[model samples]
Target: MSEFLTWLFATLFVLVVIAWYLTYTAARLDRLHVRLSGTLAALDARLVRRAEAALELANSGLLDGATALILAGAASESLESPAEHGEARETAETELSEALELALTEPVVTHVRDSGPLGQEQLAKLASACTRVQLARRFHNDAVTDVRRVRRKWTIRVFRLAGHTPMPHTIEFDDQMPATLGV
Candidate 1:
């Protein structure tokens, strides 16, 4: 009888340990999920702002073909019904393509008219901004991957048993940024 009791106690202790590990994992996963969501949201807002800036540059007669493409992509995604606006969107895309072709074939002027800094300095700042944005996006994706991996573990099936549903990939926007910032 003592032998049986000892074995039973050992088994119970092992089960408890497993349960604790799973709970810890779930908690960690939840934290990562929240962070990933927030980071993605911020990134999306920044992307929209950049796209708007590109559009503004184009409208200012800057002859920035890249900006035209950015504006077109932003417009395409922002539209609720692509089919309804297909013709107009297509025309815009064609124009943008021509602009890009022209820009690529011609020599690019490295001049910066924003008198605050030299053109090279301004270009460096833009490059740094682009790098930071890409890094943020990568970090967000990494967090998302970790969270999803934890949630998919067989030991974490208890979450499903408790009616916890898996989260879907979501892109959130910052409300503080202008609508142009979230295009």
Candidate 2:
């Protein structure tokens, strides 16, 4: 009878430990999801800000006609693209980054520098916005990676700890800024 009681107690203890572990994992996964969501929102805001800055620069009449047209078109496309989720939005953002790089050539940088305070300020804002986008993207991707790693664990799979949560994916795009932007 004592042996049976010991065995029963051990089994109960093991069950409790497993339950605790699963609960902890589930809570951690929830926190990671929240972090990913917040980071994505921040990344989107930075992208929008960068697009807005590019549009402003294009409309300022400080740049050449061709450069201004290119910048405006790219900025408009990025702004018009659906903010939800997909490769289309990522492509649009990459195009905008490319446009910014092409439009902000050395000669244009020199022109902006020579144009005085307002032009310099606009350039600075654009540079800052681009840098923010880069950082935000990195942070978001890191969060995605962490969540993915944790979700892939055997324990999580065996216990179905993640529930029905859809797998998260990393956001990838060319966020590199123009050399002339000094970012």
- lDDT per residue (tens digit) for residues 85-179 in model 2: 58999999999999998999998988987899889988999999999999999999999999999999999999888889899898888999999
**Candidate 1's residue-wise lDDT over 19-105, tens digit each?**
897778767766776787677667655444433433444444444556545545543443322332235533543443343234323
Cα lDDT for residue 104, model 1? 23
Please list the C-alpha lDDT of all candidates, in the order they appear. 0.48, 0.94
Over all chains combined, what TM-score does candidate 2 have?
Answer: 0.96
Candidate 1: clashing pairs of residues = none
Cα lDDT of candidate 2 equals 0.94
Best by lDDT: 2
Query: What TM-score, over all chains together, does every model reach?
Result: 0.55, 0.96
Query: Candidate 1's error at 161, in angstroms?
Result: 7.6
Q: What is the lDDT of residue 104 in candidate 2?
A: 97
